[model samples]
Target: MSQNVKVVQRASSSVRDKLYLPAIYDGMKITFKHFFKNLSDINAVDVLRYPEEQPQDITDRYRGLHRLTHRPDDSIACVACFMCATACPSNCMFIEAQEREDGHDEKMPKSFSIDTLECIFCGYCVEACPCDAIRMDTGIFSLTGNKREDFVLDKEQLLANKGAFGEVCSCARD
Candidate 1:
C-alpha cells in the first residue's frame, strides 16, 4: 500500500553464527556470578552458611490460612452468614447453617469446614467477614493430610489457634 517500494534486507549469517556463542557465554556468566557471590559471602560475612537463620515477620494483613473463633461459651462465633464461604475464590469453604432455638439472636454455623487442598491462600474471605469470625492469621504456612477427608478443617482446629496462639475472641453469647 505504500508508494515507496520496500527495500528487502537480508540478515547477515555472521550475526547468526555469533548469537549462539554469546547466549552460551551469558549463561555461563550468570553461573559464575552466583558462584563467586556465594563464595565471597562465605569468606567475608559467612552469610552463605545461615540461610535458614533469618525468618520473616509476616505482615499483619497476611492471609495465611482460615480460622474460626470460639466464644467463651465454647460456641462458634460465626453467625451462619456464609460471607467467608461466599468470598473464597477457590470455593473451598463448606458451611451448614443451623438455627439455635434457645432464644439466640441469630443462626450459627452448625457445621463449617474448609477443604485445605482447594484453597489458594487468598484472603478475600477473611476481609469479607463482617463478624470477624473467620481469620487467616494462624501463622500456619503449610497444611497437609494423608486422606481427602483429613484436609477438611473443622471448627475445633480453627478455634484452637485462638486459645493457643493468644488471639482472643471477645465475642460473648448475648
Candidate 2:
C-alpha cells in the first residue's frame, strides 16, 4: 500500500491581523446593530409562551417522550424481550419480565420503568424494539415533575402516553 500524506499551508498574517482590538471592535459593532434592531422591533417579534402555547408545527424527526404501544385488546404490546433495556447505553431502562397469566399473550412486563433523568434520548431503545412496542413519537418535548419519583415513567404512564397520530404497533404476533 502506498503512503498518503496531507500538506497544510498556513497563510501568514500582517501586523493588523495580530491586533485583537480591531476584531473585538468589529464584533461589538455587529452585536450593537442587532441589539438596536431587536429592541426596536421587540413588539413585532413573536415569542412563544411555553406551557400555555406550544408550537403548531412539530416535525416527525423530533424525538419526544417514550410510549409503549398497545394491542387491540387494550393490553401492552411489549413481549418483554429486553431489547430496549439491553440497548440502553445510559442504563436507565429497567424491566421486570413475567409469564403471561392469560392464554392470549406470550409474556408481559411485570414492571417497566424508565428514569427520564438518566435517559440520554438516543433513540436506541426505539430502534432495537423488534415489535415496535416502544416509540418516541409522542411529540412531547417538555417533561416536568415536582419530584424525582414523578420523572420515572412506569408501565401505566408509558401506556397512557399515546402519540398525536395515535398508538401504532406493527408486531406480527398482534
Candidate 3:
C-alpha cells in the first residue's frame, strides 16, 4: 500500500506581524483587561486560601485517599481475597489473610498495609476489589507525614478512613 503525503505552506507574515509589536499589545490588553476586571470584582478571580479556607465545590467523583468499606454488621466488608494486591502494578498493597474466629466471615485480613510512598495512586485496588470493599472517594488528598512509617497505612488506618466517607456502593463493577 502507498501513502500520500500532503504538502504544507507557511503563512506569509506582514511587516507588523514580523515586528511582533501587535502581539505584545494584544497580550498587554488581555492582561490589563483581567487586572481591571479582577480589581472591579475580586470574586471574579479564584484565590484559594488553602488549609484555612477549603474549596466548596468538590465533586463526588473526585479521587482522593483510599478507604475500605464495612458491612451492615459493622465488620469489615473485605474478604481478604487478595484481588486488590494482585491487581496493583506497583506492588504496594500488602495483605495477610486469616480465618475469622467469629465464623461470620470466611476470612479476614490479619495485617493489611499500603505504602503510600510506593503507591502510584492508580486506583487499581479499588477497581480490582470484588466485594465493593475499597474506594478512593474520601476526597481527603492532603496525605502528608513527617516520618516514613506514617505513610504506611495499616488496616486500622484504612478502616478509619472509611468513617470519614461511607461505603461507595456504585464504584466497583464487572
Candidate 4:
C-alpha cells in the first residue's frame, strides 16, 4: 500500500509585517479614536463609581466570596467532612474537627477558616461539600482588608455571611 504525502507551503511575512510598525500604528489609531470619542461624551463610556455604585447585573450564578451555610436549627451544616479542604487547589482551607457535644455521633468543626488571600475563588470547596454546607454565592466580589488576618474568614464570619438573596441558610437544603 502506497500513501500519498502532501507538503503544504508556509506563507512568508512581508517586510512591513516583519517590522510590525504599521500594525502598532493601526492599534494606536483605534485606541486614540475611542479615547477622544469617550472624552467628548463621557456617558458613552460606562464607568461605575465603585463602592457607591454596586453592579446591577450580579446574577445568581456569580461566584463571589465563600460562605458557610446553616441548618434549619441555626447550627452549622458542616459535618467536618474535610471534603472542602481536600478539594481546595490553593490549600487555603483549615479545619479542626471535634465530636459533637450533643447526643449525636456526627462530628462538627471546632474551627474552620479560609484564607481569602490565598483562595483562588475556584468554587471547588463548595462543590466538594456533600451537605451543601459551603457556598460562594455571597455576591461579595469586592474583598478588602487592611491586614492579612482580616481576609481570613473564620467559621463565625463565614456563618454570618448571607447568600446573594440575603439568606443565611442554603435554599437548596431548605
Candidate 5:
C-alpha cells in the first residue's frame, strides 16, 4: 500500500472573539428573567399550601410509590419467583418465595421488599412482573426518610393503594 497523508487546519479565533462571552450572559439572562418573572407572579402562582391543599387530578402514568396487588380474597397476587428482583436494574427488589398450598391460584411472597433507597424508580420491576402483582400507579413518586431501613418498603405499605382503596388500578387491567 502507498503511504499518503493529508492535513487540514482551522483558523484560530482572535482576542476579540475570546473576549466575547454572550453565551454565558445569555444563560445568566435567562435565569434572571425567570427569577424576576417568578417574583412578579408570586401571587398568581399555584403554589400549593400543601398542608391545606391537595391535588384532585393526577396523570395515570405517574410512577409513584409501589403497590402489591391483592386477590379478591385479600391474598397477595405475587408468585415470589424473584422475577422482580431479577428484573430490577438497581437491585432494589428483594423477595422470599414460598410454595402455594394445594390448588392455590398463586404462590405468595413470604417476604418482599423494594429497598426504595436503592431503587432508581425506572419501573423495570413493575414491567418485569409477569403476574400483574406489582404497580407504581399511585402518583406518589417521592418516598422520603432519615435511614436506609426506613426505606425498606413493607407489605402493609405495599398493599395500601390509598384512594385506590383495595381495588385494582389501571396498571393491572393493562
Candidate 6:
C-alpha cells in the first residue's frame, strides 16, 4: 500500500509582522479603551469592594459550601453509607460509622469531616448522597482559616452551619 504525502508551504512573515509593533499597539489600544471606559463609568465595570459589598447575584443553584441536613426530629440525615465520601473526586471527605443508639438499628456517622483545603467544591458529594444528607446550599463561599486544621470541618461544625435563611436544616424530607 502506498500513502500520498501532502506538503504545505509555511506563510512568510513581513518585516512589520516580525517586529510585533502592530500587535503591541493593538493590545495597548484595547487596554487603554477599557481603562478609560471604566474610569468614565465605574458602574459599567464589575469591580466589587469585597468584604463591604457581598455578591447579590448568587443564584439558587450556586454551590458555595457544604452543610449537613437533619431529619424532622433534628437528627442528622446521614446514614453513614459513605456515598458522599466515595463520590468525592478529591478524596477530601472522611467518615466514621457507628451503630445508632436510639434503637433505630441503623448506622450513622460517628465522625464526619471534610478537608476544605483538599476539596475542589465540585458538588459531587452533595449529588451522590442518597438520603439528601449533604448539601452545598449554605452560600458561605468565603472559606478562610489561619491554620490547616481549621479548614477541616467536623460533624458538629457541618451540622451547625445554616442556610441563607438561617435554617439549620435544609432537608427536603423535613
lDDT (0 to 1) per candidate: 0.75, 0.88, 0.83, 0.87, 0.74, 0.86
| The best candidate in terms of lDDT | 2
Instruction: Give residue 22's lDDT in candidate 6 (0 to 100).
Output: 92
Q: RMSD per prediction, one decimal?
A: 4.2, 4.7, 6.0, 3.9, 4.5, 3.4
Worst ten in a row by lDDT for model 1: 46-55
Model 3 C-alpha RMSD to native: 6.0
Instruction: Tell me which of candidates 2 and 4 scores higher on TM-score.
Output: 4
Q: Judging by TM-score, tell me the better candidate of 1 and 4.
A: 4
lDDT of 6 by residue, 1-174 (tens): 999999998786888889999989999999999999999998888778998999898887788778898876777888899999999999999999999876443788999999999999999998899878888888887888789999999999999887775555444351
lDDT, candidate 5, 78-117, per-residue tens: 7776888898888888777777773444567777887887
RMSD of 1: 4.2
User: Where is model 3 more than 4 Å wrong at Cα?
Assistant: 1-47, 163-165, 168-174
lDDT by residue (21-117, candidate 3, tens digit) is 9889999999999899999998878788988998888777777878887776677878899999999999999999999876556788999999988
TM-score of every prediction relative to native: 0.68, 0.75, 0.65, 0.77, 0.69, 0.77
- Is candidate 1 or 3 superior in TM-score? 1
TM-score of 5: 0.69
* TM-score of model 6 vs. true structure: 0.77
**Considering lDDT, where higher is better, how would the candidates rank from best to worst?**
2, 4, 6, 3, 1, 5
Over the full model, what C-alpha lDDT does candidate 6 score relative to the true structure? 0.86
**Better TM-score candidate (2, 6):** 6
